[model samples]
Structure formats: structure tokens, C-alpha cells
Target chain A: MPKTAFQRVFPYLLVLPTFVFVALFTLYPVTRTVTDSLYKPARRAADPSVFVFLENYADLFDSTHYLGARFVQILGNTFAFTLATVVFSVPLAFLFALLLNRQLRGTGFLRFAIFYPALLPLIGAASIWAFFYSDTIGLFNTILRGFGLTGVNWLGDPNVVLYAIVLLNIWKQSSYCMIFYLAGLQNIPRDIYEAAQLDGAGWFYQLRYMTVPLLRRTTLFVVLITVTYSFQTVEQLQVLNQGNPADRGNLLLYFIFQSIGERRNWGYVNAMTVVLVLLLLAFTLTNFLLFERRDDDKA
Target chain B: MLQRSLRMLCLLLVASLLAVTPFVQAQAQVVVDFYYPTAVDGPITQTIQEYATKFEAMHPNIKINPVYTGSYTQTRDTIRTELAAQDVIVDVAVMLATDLTSFVEEETIVPAQQFIDRMENGEAFVANFFEAFLANCRDEEGTIWSVPFQRSTPILYYNADLFRAEGVEVPRNVNELIEVAQKLHTPERAGLLMPVAGGFPIWLYQSFAAGFGQPLIEADPAKVYFNSDASLAAVEFLTKLGMPTSEGGFGVGPMGGSVWGDTPTAFTSGQAAMIYHTTGSLTNILRNATFEVGVAFLPSGLPNENGEGYAAPTGGGNLYIFAATEPEVQEAAWLWVEFLASDEVQSDWGARTGYVAATRGAWEIDPLKTLVEEKPQYLVARNQLAHAYKEFDSYRSIDVQLIINNALSSIISGNVPLSQAKATLDAAQAQIDSLLAEYR
Candidate 1:
């Protein structure tokens, strides 16, 4: 079939801007990071960078001193943080969505209240939380003392710091995921629930068999977004912990930040970035596969 | 046709005038980009801009572009990023004085000696600054690479009201500090707060090491005494302060460590009876505290053979001109540096911002002198300069600092057993040794 020349040219023009942007930002940086990971950066600008091949990667895992020993801990912290965020936030968000979906008194007010934490900037939220988490004069300790209970060192104790940060993340993130779940809830026709009610299905039974399955797509989407968001947690760490209290709260991203800012080891930092990128890619691929399998089952 | 051609000639003449004026202006103008960080509170950006405006007014041909970079750490990072990108946008900057070694190693900065030598009263100009403030500006060979600007040292800030009510004298030595702190300790208020928490405990910890008779870094940037006996005593003293009494500790402050930013607030609010904080916080503390505030030198636990028990590490920023700049631009930048470090400006800055003026001349000047007469807290930091040492700095400093800081935080937080504290330091020393292996 003969196509008009303008039609073909117009399509290329339409794609050009996006392609150029992706090439400049995403593709270029990723390629540069990969190349940088393979070489040892020069100590000084005048010195030439040495090609170290996979030595940077080996250094990351093999060397026990320096950042190597902490790498495992940081990797564990990253996974734990992401898992906890996803696990707690998804369920809490689902509960909020279900409650908000109900026709009840003060639903509008409740919706606003739940979403308030999400509205605050991460740094601002971290600052407020720092005040709340202060050991001597913080709001949390004061309240605990009022109840004749001993105060907890929320941000300072190595044991409790990660969970303290997790709580902040859950507080900020659950509401965000709830918005997605709310839209998902809206998309589900209410008549199906009514039909289930007519069949004498208990609330729990319907929730398990009906509401849960219906929201699978939304849950998967929310989980994917939340997981990626969890992996990129740096600002809160910067403001609240700075990978401190014995690096208990140090996550992968903050570790990368320290590597660059403190050590100026671009090669090591790039290697860390490469590992992080691979981790995210694997998670995304797994999610995609899950989604594809579900579609196949339906087909 | 003749009239049209005449009009065109006039237009061409006007266009040429407009084009040539900027070129002439460019020929006469040398623009210097001055980057500074505001580590303390108040209208710092405005104050810096005001100084730049005053300087520009005096030298109309040289334009001063004053950029308020976020914090000292941020300013260093920004400069490093620019250097790595080969942009070198900053002509002169107020970077951490401890960054001198790093800058020298990278060959990114021109030594201030070159410019000072060119000055008529260069020797006196260098001598005008307090010796402690100049400690961080020189390398092993004693080449001056920076000019001291916003210099400070840690001092003990105590609640005078609490000390008076308790009927106790101010602690002058480490042993007395422990005794006084323990006596003032209560369930509600901590006796002492040392703001040596998180990633950078080495600054305040240096005072402890120096008091114990072993400084962390000397002029030799290749070496540090992280595992020295004096270093061990310093850490032990610091650890005992925060440890519970049952655990063979002084049980004074929080178990891990008090935060840097919260230290002044704690003292001012009476949550802490005493705190080790930067002299930069003096004005802020005086402004906020309802009770009388007393400033004293940091008491090193043991007295030196000279019978001096006080020790502190000097900190804060120094003005550095980068090497990448044009010679004329570097000269212009040096002029801006001198203008900022001038006695008049230094005195005004010290009085306004609570930073101890780098030069003794600034101390003898009007505003600072009068402020000292009225409050007298400002003089304590300057008086303590006699006991101050160079801050911990070396080749690969940030990396070495991280190792030491992590170890100290772990030890202080009780993650490392007191029995194993020495072992932890040894491991840190090993890491630092490897890090500085290239230099050696």
C-alpha cells in the first residue's frame, strides 16, 4: 500500500523528541555508569583513569574492610525496608480504600486526613518526624513519660532506628497507595458485591474471594510502584539518619550517596548503581511475568 | 538613494557602538565567582551579598558574584562536582579548612602564599591571623593554600543558672568535668551533651585526643594515630560519659551520642546542663537562653606536662582560590578574599554571626570588642585559641573520617563492647592505612 510521504515523516517527527530525551537522559547515563563501573577513577583530574574491568564489582563484595562489610548489611537493609514498606503499606492502603469506599459519616474528612502525610515533602516530613523522635525532648518521649512509661530512643538507637524509619515510610506511603486503590475500588462495579451479598457470602468470604481478586491488577500496579519507591529511599535517610546509629538505617541509595559525596569513588559508586539497576530490573521483570501469566490464565 | 544610504550609515554607526561597548566593558571587567556556605543561622546569605556589594562598589571594574552554597559539606561537594565535570565555575570558595589536603592533592587550588608574597605587607598579613586558625591552611612543607575566614573551635557551653544553683564551680579539667557532670545529673536533665553523633564525630573527638596528648593528624597528611594510647584514652573517656553507671560508665548524656544541631537547643532549654559545641553557637545560645550562659574551654581529661588541661580542635571554612581560574581572575578572587578577611569585615561578621574572628586584629576592633565588653562570652573562644589544635585532616580524609566515625559511633552506642573498643579502633586504623597506602 502506498503511504503519503508526510504520514511516514510525521510519525518519525512525533517519536523524535521522546527518543532524543530518552537517549540523552536514561540511555546515556546508564551506559556511562556501566562504563564507569568497569574502570578505576583517577585520584586527581590530571591523572588518567585506569581500566579495572570487574575489579570494582569484586571490591564491592570481596573486601571486608571499607564499604564491603557494610554492603551486605546495606543490601539486607534495602530489601527489608522495601519488603516492610510494601507489606504494611499495601494492606493498610487497601483497608483505607475499602473504608473510604463505604458511604459513611466524615468520609471526606477521613480521606483528607489519610492523605495528609503524602502532601508534605519528604525532607519536611523527616524534619517533623525528627522532632517527634528526639530522645530527650521529642514529642514521642514526652508522651511516653506522661503515661509513666520509659521513653524509647526512636532515631538514635541502632536496634529501633530502622523500624522508626519504616513507620515514617508506612505513614507517608500507605496513603499514596490508597489513592490508587480508591480508583481501583471505583472501577469495580458495586453490583457484584451486592450479588455476592444475596448469595449469603460472609464479608470476609467476599473480601477474600471477590474484592481481593477484583483488585489484583490494582494491587500489582501499586506493589510495583511502591517497591520502586522503597528502593529509592535516600532523602529521608539524609534528613533523619544519614546512615547513622551505627549504619543500622543505611540503605543502598544512601550508601551510594556517601560513596560519591564522602569518598569521591566514582567507580565504586557506579558499580553500586549497576547492582541497584539490576535489582530493580529483576523485580520489574518478575512483576511483568506475573501480569502476563494472569492474562494468559484469563485467556 | 543618497538619503537612504545616509540613513543606513547612521544605523550601522549605532549598531557598532552598541556592539563595541560590551567588548570594552569586558576588557575592563574581571568577574570573580565567590562560593561560600552558611553552616550557622541568621541572614548569612544577605550578609555575604552585602559584603560583595561593598567590595564591588570599591572596585567597579571587578564584579563579585557571591553564591550561597547550602552547607560546608554541600559547598565542597559542589566544588568537587564542578572540578570533576571540568567546568570549574567557582573561582573562589569558602570550603572546609580540612579540605586543604584534598585540594592540594588534586592540584585544584592555588596556594595563598603566591598572592601573599606579592603583597607589600605579606608577612604581617599572614601573621595577623590567630596561629590556631592558620593551622589548617598549611601543608607539610608549610605552604599556605587558604586564608582563614569563618574559623571556629568547640567550646563547652554550660547553663550558668544550673551551675550556680548546684553551687559548683565550672570544670577546668576532664576529671573535674566528669565529677561536675555526675553531680548535676538528674532523671530529667542530662549533665552533659557532646554533639558527636552520626557520620562526623571526629571533630569533637579530636579535642579529646589532643587533651590525652596525641593529636589525630599532624602536618604529615599520610599518617594518623587512630589506635594510639592517647586516642584510646580519649575514646574511653567519651564512652564512659554516655554509658550507664551499672555498665561502668558515667551515665551523663544519651547512650549513643547527642546530635550536633540539637546540642545548643538542649543547653538553652535546660535539657542539658552542659554541652560541647562550636563557638559559632555562642550568639544563638545567648540570644535564646533565658538563663545566663557560660562559655569555657573544652576540658581534656588529663593535664598536659605544661599543666594545661584545655584542648580544642579548630574548625569552619577557609577562603580558597582555585587554580583553574585565569591569573587576573585569581587576583580578583584574592582581593575579594582579603576584603572578607579584613579586620573590619571579620569583626563585623564575628559580632553578627558568633564565629570567632580569624585575625587578632578583628578581636581588637570596635564591634567585636564592644560586644565582648558587654557579653564577654565572645572572648572565651578567642582566649581558648591558645589551646586549640588543627582539625583532623589528611589525604583521603573523608574516607578515613568515615571509618573512624563509624567505629566511634558503634563504640559509643555500645554495639562494640568496651573490652573490644581498642580492637575496633585497630580495625579502623587498618582500613585508613589501606586507604592512604597510595600516598605512603
Candidate 2:
């Protein structure tokens, strides 16, 4: 029995290296960030050793400075961006995966076409989109001008910049989500669909009752990953808009980066980072509570 | 069979380790990494690589690693974080003109005066550099913490073809320039292009403010002077051009429609009539432009009634040696700096690239002078240098610049009234004052 126990524990022991790597690389920095957030350190050259406690966090709420307002706005923008991405991308991915599964001619080519955007580096993709968003000499503006329509500032207009970025995100991420959805589709038992057909169930009925329920885990996984990535989206904002047109497109991650990277307000950036970690924790815990029960019920 | 496999694996491992061992030993070859930000396109990366290869060949004992670390701001952040980790990985860096003060405060850079004093080969290295370049390199104590590498000032680049077509005379002063711009502007074409983007607009406004005898920051360099009447007038003038018609705006400012995409494309493409851009853009313009380009001084906001012009700000990059590197490496780095700053090298670099040479002797070099005679744009930059003011480089200056830029953007977009804009700037000045107190 003890031998069996040791054998059972051996696999975990073998995986111990990965655990140590994660702790050192990920947990260490995160813990450091949390600690640093509480203390303000002088970041400039002349006076390098001054430390003030909790003042950095207090600066976050100093309304006159606009940092606090900017933070709240960025959070709202991040949530909106993530929610829109999930709403548009998840359904379209599922639909595309369904169509791809249909043994249609040139389906492989179609899949390749769909997957192309994901292959591009973020900056490269953003650059291409920035060209398209250019007020003059852009493909969109050219077409609009040809049609005698006024060219809108796609990036410069704060009202539309967020949506424009969302469009870019959808283009890049939907294909990625489709790959996952297609895998889930392929794993659904052929016999179950056959049984459904024998019972004279319609295609819609089978898809509604049989396909979606089986893909619940996949759907949950995609939503979680997509939301996490949305919070971390910096490249598009950094390259294309750079929080332009009155700082409208600024997201939380980019805001934190601007604080530390551009401004060198390390203490303020750390405090914001701690807040972001708390947000991520809250999101993960809520997701677990809501979905883990459903997963158990389904099983 | 297992013994044979083990013998083969051992042989493979030994071979691989032998192959890697030389590379590991090569790392011990006085390795010095250089971090530079390319102001131009990716082709500059090749130029940097060539410089590195030459340096390595000259000093066979040292291995030079050249890294392109993105924009100026990105390079600053990367170097800071690396230094904070106590990693003296970057032995040399190309820093923005304004970044010297912050770097010195962090003790991330060594004073260059000692290196200037130590050069071999009977070279009068420090004396050869342009006088205007010293304003940025010198610390508060008048110590040379950095050496000017690439120097540039804003100049007016107009499409001569467009001016001829429109029968508009080149403007010598701001008022005439605005009148010409109004006449030259077509809805289908841009009259001028001012970057409403961060920093560029502020720089343009500061140029005008400087011409009007207004300082961007106080003499102490501890507080912003952007809330002053002169600055307010400059902002008002800029905002009139940038605001939309619905907001009672004029249109895009000077470089607007005419400025090209990345290169001098807009002017070359006949999209705009005139452009105000850095002298560094001269080479790109000359190389790409098929049209006759007219080079002139930047429009003077406070031109004498007789149309005499005052100088604007000179903006560009400088090279700083880090204090943490070994003495030998510092010597090698200084060798590179001195070589680049030599009249022959500077002239060649200036002729090849659009950037003006940091050394004054570059103008006396026959080839560079010939290039300038052929291309009047080069001469325009040289003439402007006489009137150029160095941007403030105190630790709080960048933050102050950022604030001014943000406020200027608001003003230009017509989101804030003139009084409100002034009030906003006053608040920013207060913030700058606090930063100055804390840092300076």
C-alpha cells in the first residue's frame, strides 16, 4: 500500500520543477509588487532614498491630478472591451467552427485564412490597422472619399477609438477561439448526434441541446482566457492610439505602464498593479464559484 | 545495445558542450552592450550594426553587442530597470537631449569630461564639438555628463512647386505665414500639418514662445513657466489652427496636410504646401523628393518688424557613458565617441544621415560643405543653429513637458477655454513645482 502511495506521489514529485519555476518567476514578482505598492520610494536620481508610506495610494484618489479619474475610466474601458470581445468573438468562433466541421470544399484554406491574423505579432497587426485608421492615405478613408463620405478620425476620435480597437481584437482573437471550439466539436461523440437524428431532432435542436452542453467546459475556458487577455491588452493601445484624443482609449494595464514606464512614478504604478491583482483575484474567484458548481451539476 | 546507446549519448553531449564552450569563453571578451534608439527607420539598425562591427574589429579584445531598444522613452525605461537590478549590461546608451539630468540624478551615467581629457591620437576632441551642444551635456555643476551625438533644430520645408502653382510668396514671419497658409490651403490638400500628438505640438508652441522671448521653464529649472501670458498667447495661436470648424477652429497647423507619412511623403506627394520638421528630416527629404524643395528658417512669432528672425529650440539625441562599466570599457566607448565626433566622421555621418554633425568643424569639411551647397536644406539647419536655444534638462523638466503637452492638446482641440487652459497650466505648474522640490 505504501509502495502504491509512493508511486502515486511520484508523478507530482516529477512535476515539482514546474511548480518551483512558477513560484520563482511569477509569485515572487507579484508578491514584491504587492509589498512595493504600500511604500513610496523616491524614483529620481538626485534623492534616491526617500520612502513615504501609503502616499502613493492616496495619490490615486487625488481628484485634481486626474490620475484617479483616469484609473476609473480605464477600468471601465477594460471591462467594456473584454465583455464586447467575449460577446462577439465566442459566438462567431462557435459558428465558424461548426461551418468548418461541415466537410466543405476548401475548408482547410478557409481555416488558414481565419487563423492568419493570430499569427501576426501584436505590433505588426496594430501597425497595419493604424494605417487603415489613418485619416488620409488610408484604405478606409480612400473608400469613404470615393463614396463622397466624410472621413472620420478612427483613432483620434475618443468616442470611436475603443470600438476600433475592439474590432481589431475580434479579428485577431476569433480565429484563435475557433481553433478551440473546433477541437471541442471534433470530440463530441458521433453516436450521440446519430441518436439525435434518429429521434427526428432538427439541426437547431441538436445544436442547442447536445452540442452546447457538451462544450460548456470549452466555452468557460475561452471566456476566462479572453477576459484575462483583455485586461493585459497593451500593444494595440500603445501602438495605434496611445490613449489619444483626450486619453479616452487608455486601459488599466496601459495606465499602470504609463505611470511607471513613462512617468517613472514607480510607487503609484505598484499601487495600481496591486489593485489590478485584486481585481483578477476577484474575477477568478467569482468565476470558480459560479462555474465549478455548474460543472459538478453537469457531471 | 544499452552500452552502445550510452556511448553515443556521451559522445553527443561532449560534442555539444565543446561547441558551446567557445561561445561561453567568448562572453568573457570584455563584452560591452550598446543600447540605441533609432530616430529614423529600420535601415538605421544596419548602420548601428556596422558601427558595432567596426568597433569590435578595432578592439579585438572587446565584443560589442548592439541593441535597438525602440523609442527614446522605451530606452530610458529599459536602462533604468536594468541599472536598478545592478546589471551593468548596457555600457553605452543614446539618450534624448532632455534625459541627461534624470540619468545623472540616478547616477546611471558618468561624467564625460574625464573621458574628453583622456583621448589619444593628438585629437582636440572636446573643443571640436559645437558650442550649442554643450548646453544639454553639462550638468548643474557644469560637468559634462554626456556628449552630443545627433543634433537637430526645426526648420520650414516648403514645396516650391506648390508655392509657384499657388503664386504664394514664402512667408518670412508668422503673420505672413498664416496668410499664405490660408490662401494655399485646399480641402483636397493640407496647407500645414502640426502634430496634435503629444510632445510635437508642445515643442512647436515652445519654439514660438522662445521666439517671443518666453522661457519654457523657470531659470532654476524647478518650475514650469507655461502658465505665463506669452505661453497662453502661443497656445491660443496654435489652438486656432488645430480646432475643428465647428469649434471655431482654423485648420491643421503649419506641417499639417503637407507633412509626409514617416518620410517627407506628404510634401513629395503634393498633399501639403509647407512643412515644419526637424533638420534630421533633410536627408530623407532630399533622397525621396522629386520636387524642388525650398528650405527656410522656422517662422518667427516675434520677428522684428523688418522680418528679422529669432532662434528656436534645438532638439536631438546625445551619447552617455554609464559609470558602472570598467575603466577599459569606458576608454573603448570614448574611442567610439571621439571617432564619431571627428570632423571627417561627423561630416560623413551628417551627409549620409539627415542629422547635423555635433562638431562645428564638420561644416569646414569639403564634402559636407559641398553637400550643403547642393542641398540648401543642410544650410538652413546650420543657419538656424545660431538662433537655437537648448531645451531645459532638469529632472522635473520632462514631467513639466508632459503636462504642458497634455494641456496644449486640450487647448488645441478647443476642449478648454483660454482662461480655463491657463488655469489648467497653472495647476500643472504647481505639480511641477512639487516634483522639482522632491527631485531637484
| Among all candidates shown, the one with the greatest DockQ | 1
DockQ of each: 0.60, 0.21
Distance from true location, Cα of B302 in model 2, Å: 2.3
Query: Mind giving the per-residue lDDT tens digits that candidate 2 earns over A201-266?
Result: 999999999999999889988888888888888998877766654556668888777666443567
Residue B160, model 2: lDDT of 90
Q: For residues B10-104, what per-residue lDDT tens digits would candidate 2 score against the true structure? A: 99999999999998877577766788887765377787777778767877777777888998878888987877677768888888988876777
Give per-model TM-scores.
0.96, 0.88
Q: Which residues of candidate 1, in runs, are more than 4 Å off? A: A4-7, A262-264, B1-27, B303-307
Instruction: Report residue B142 deviation for candidate 2 (angstroms).
Output: 2.9
Place model 2 in a CAPRI quality band: incorrect
Predicted structure with the largest TM-score when compared to the true one: 1
Residue-level lDDT for B350 in candidate 1: 94
Question: How far off is residue A284 in model 2, in Å?
Answer: 1.9
Best by lDDT: 1
